[model samples]
Each structure stands twice: as structure tokens, then as C-alpha cells.
Target: MTIQRHVPATDAADRAMLEGWLDYHRQTLAQKCEGLTDEQLRTASVPPSDLSLMGLVRHMADVERGWYRRVLAGEDAEPLHYDEADPDGDFHLTGTETWQEAYTTWQAEMDVARRNAAGFGLDDLARGRHRSGERFTLRWIHTHMIEEYARHNGHADLLRERLDGATGD
Candidate 1:
């Protein structure tokens, strides 16, 4: 049940600002999965859908990899590992892998994403194709990441609550 907290942001102004939210969001998600077993993490509390803590970890790994490796770096990232014939596949863990494995994958993806996100100017432009074919800038991507993490963190909070009675800030 032991979890390590991230170190505080340093004196670098840009990093302190840009990475502050990202760090907090990462910690929040980690906190959501704290003190849970593999079976509990893989259990889909909400029926009819396979969304679980392990699934969310896998999904986040896919997301970080997609955005940082594929979209940002143009590396032709394959679909998410859990995306098996269905677009929503990442929301479910369909295999026997342990929760620790999922968490490890998530950490790997986050490390890559953090490295990719570092040193980019807010005004830096990176192109992405959306459903509407709209062009986006790096600033937009950063904002979107923050928004996405926050939104998912809310869902994780509720999911964690359902998993265990332990809940708090």
C-alpha cells in the first residue's frame, strides 16, 4: 500500500508552469489506483462495459504513446494495445496481465510523453488531424492534454471510490 510522491517542481519557470498540471494529474491518477489488488483493478464495476482501473492505465498508456510518439513525432504509432477490433477496446483489460504490468506500461509511456513534451515552446506548432480536419498548435495540444487528464481523473476518482472505501483529496 506504499506509494511515492513526485518531487516538487524546480526553479525553472517554463517547466514549473507547463509541468505543474501534468505532474499533479499523474499523481492524482496514481493515487486513484493506490492499495488495490490486481483482481480489483481488473474488475469492471460498471456492468455492460469493461472499464476498469487496469483498463484506464492501459488506455492512458495508449493515449500518451499516441499523442507523444505518433502525432507529435510522426512515428506511425500503432493502435493501442487494448484496441482489439473495437475503438473502445482500450477501456478494457482482456488479458491475464497483472495490475503491476499495466502500471509499468503506463509509467513507460508517461516517461516518453514527458520527454517529448519538454522544451517545446507554447507557440510551437505541431499538426494533428481531427475529425473536422482542423489544424492544432502545441499550445492547443497542451491545453487538451490538461483537459483530458482532468476529465479522466474525475472518472478515476469515482471508480476508485467504488473499488474501496478509502477516498480523499
Candidate 2:
């Protein structure tokens, strides 16, 4: 799969730099999923772990909604595909959810995230109660999102390798 790689700006404002990195990481995840089939995407990374390419997509969609819609935009975001009842539903396809749905949902959330973020500056304050009951800022959310994607992209790398022996930056 040919993943579309975007060159992040070398010299830019703080916001641009952060956004560029975040966008870069986003594309990286998509690149990892580029050539995978439904079965391949649904393939778990390791035993006792439900992590997969499609699962990552679903989980990231949830993440995008949580941060961009709920936290950033304060849009009273409801659960996208998971809840307290089944926290891991994002990763559990169970043959009910198709790979296409995951991709479309992920892209849709990405769109919302981008739109929601457009109005805020880096230092813009958005009150959000984390799962741990901690307040957060839009800046923190941006940095957290980058780290989240980087961590998951690492897992994606391993998963892709397991799936098709693919590897590299």
C-alpha cells in the first residue's frame, strides 16, 4: 500500500508545528492500513490482545470524537462505538462491523476533529474532564493526541509486520 506522506513544515509557528506533526502521525496510521484486507485488518496483534489495524482505526475515531468534539468543541459528545458497558467495543468487531465502516467512521471523525480545531489557538483553554477526572487544555489535547498516535503507530508497525512482513519509517 502506498501511504501518502506529508512533509511537515521545518520552520513554523508553534501551532503549525504541532498540527503538522499530528497530521503526519495521522497519515502514518492510514499508511499502515493502506493495503490490508478486512480479514487482515481484523487480525489481532498478539494473543490476549484485541489490537488490530481496524481496531486502531475504530479506537482513534473514538479518540478523535472524545478530544475534538467533546473536549474541544464541548459538543456533548455521545459514545461513538463504545461505552462503559463494553469499553473495548472499538476493538471488538465480532463480524458485525465491516472494515469499510471502520475506515469511513475514522475519516469522518478526523474531519470533525479538524473542523473543531480550526477555531482554537494553541493556548486556547477548553475544559475537559478526563477519565481520571483531570482538567485539560486544547494544547494538552493536541500534544496528547500526537503521543497517542505515535504509540499506536508503533503497535501498528508491529501489527503490519505480523500481517505482511512490512516495516520502515
Candidate 3:
């Protein structure tokens, strides 16, 4: 499927702008993984680092769930790919999940994130605390999510270019 990334409007309200950019980055990540076989999606960037396109998708899914469901909505959501014993489990795939599965899961998490944030204003506090024991406002979460995707999307660009010479913003 083709991923459509809309550029965020420069003159929009804070929440609209944040959501637009976040979605753009999300679609950017999806576009980076398009047209690759499962093995190619799972291919590591380097010998030591287990980072791959599939791993990024899995990681983002967990990130969305953590921030939106666990924090914002106060839902008892569990991590899909990690635990205390294996904190980075999402990035270290067991070779059983297909690319479609990972993509579907990520999209589902995104849907939940949108729903969870719909009723909250920018200054509203989250229901949960960060690892540092600090509570976050909706604005902070939105900004942090954009930064998270932006950084990971950069890694995705490098990985994609390395895999198939495909690169773009």
C-alpha cells in the first residue's frame, strides 16, 4: 500500500500542527518500509546492531501504546514486544511475525493514540507518570512523539538507502 504523508500546515493551531507533523512522520516511516520483502524488512543495518525496518515498526507500536493507552487514557495496556527481562524485544524479532502483522499492529496503535488524545487539550496532564516520575501534558507528549518519530525516521532513511538505495524526506 502507498503511504500518504501530508505536510503540516505552518499557520495552524498548536494541536492541529502537532498532529499533522506526527502523522507525516508516521507515514514517512511506513513509506520507508514499502515494497520490501519480509527478509528485506527484517534485514539488519549492521552486524552488531539488530535495528531493521520491521524493528522500527514494532518499536513505534509499543511507543504509541505506552504513551496513548497507558499514559493518556490510563488503560492497562501491555507492551506488545518487550518486557522487563527483554526490554528491547521489539527490535529483536523472533522471525515469526510478518511485515503485514507488524504494520497492522502499528496502525492499530496509531488509531488508539488518536482516539485517546481526541478529548484532551494541549495543557491537560497525562494519567500516568514518566520513568523519571514526572507527569506530562498533552503538548509535551505530542512534541515528544514528533521528536521520537523524526529521529527514528532518520534511522529508517539510512536503513532504506542501505537496503535498496531508496531515500527521501
Candidate 4:
């Protein structure tokens, strides 16, 4: 394993740097999913699990919709990519979906997330009380989403590499 070190941010504002990290991962994830066919995108290189590149795109879309649109906006809406009726529906077979559709949906979701992020004050309070009684603010959710994207991007790196030896950071 190789560790890459990023230089300390020269930017004065901590929040901007954090936002940059979030945007960076969002873009990185998109790049990782670029230019693959539907079969390649949905192919589970590792059996017994349905972790596909296309699936990740769908999942991230759901995350953005759920977090920014639903949780942050406090909207009463059904969850995307998730259902008690079919827990694995999103990943298993995205249903003859064209590459453009998948990519477009991912881009749209990211756009919404960006718009939502723009509306927040540096000190804006975003609160969500978890089922476990833990509370989170918008700042926390923003950072957490960045962490989520970064972690999944790592998985994407390996999975894509395994598929075509096309590895990247």
C-alpha cells in the first residue's frame, strides 16, 4: 500500500478547504465512473456482492437526494435507491439504462448538492437527530458526506483496477 500526502491547505478559510475536499471527491467519483459500458459498470468482479461502478453512481445520487433534498430540506419524500420491497434493486440491475442516463442522474444530483451547499452560512446550523438520538449539523453532514465519498472512491479505485488494470488515485 502507498500513502499519498497532501500539502497543508494554504487557504486561510477552513470551511473553503473543507468544501474543496468535498467537491474534489465528488468529481473524482464521477471520473472513476466515466467511459464504461453498462455491462462493465454493473459487472460484479467479486461474487456474492453487488458492488458495481454504476451502482455507486446510483447510490451516490440517492445519497445526495436523501441528504440535501430530504434531510437538509426536511422534505417528506420516499427514499431513492432503497426499498424494503427490494433491498438490492438499485445495484442488481439498473434495467437497460443507458450510460447517459446513469451519468446524467449522477451529475444532476451533484448539482443539487452544490446548490444546497451554496445556501449555507458559515455558521448556519443544520441539525438532524438520528434514530440513535445523536444529532448532526449541516457542517457535520457536509464533512461526513465528503468522508463517505472519499471512502467509496477508494473502493471504486480497486474495483476499476481489477476490471481493467486502470488504476488511479
The per-model lDDT (C-alpha) reads 0.73, 0.87, 0.93, 0.73
lDDT of 4 by residue, 1-169 (tens): 2223343367747677777787778778777766677788877766677788888888888887777766665555465677888876667665586567777887787788778767766556544444355545678778889899999898899778877888877
What is residue 57's positional error in candidate 2, in angstroms? 0.5
Residue 60 deviation, candidate 1, in Å? 0.8
Look at candidate 3 and tell me the lDDT of residue 51: 97
Candidate 1 all-Cα RMSD? 2.7
> All candidates' TM-scores?
0.84, 0.93, 0.97, 0.84
TM-score of 4: 0.84
The collision pairs in model 2 are none
lDDT measured at residue 42 in model 2 versus the true structure, 0 to 100 = 91
Q: Judge candidate 1 at residue 106 and give its lDDT.
A: 88
Candidate topping lDDT: 3
lDDT of 2 by residue, 19-50 (tens): 88999999999999987788899989676888
- Which stretch of 10 consecutive residues in model 2 shows the poorest summed lDDT? 126-135
Q: Which stretches of candidate 3 lie over 4 Å from their true place?
A: none
Cα lDDT of model 1 by residue, 9-44, tens digit: 576575465567777777778888888888888888
* Ranking, TM-score, top scorer first: 3, 2, 1, 4
Roughly what TM-score does model 1 have, to 2 decimal places?
0.84
Ranking, lDDT, top scorer first:
3, 2, 1, 4
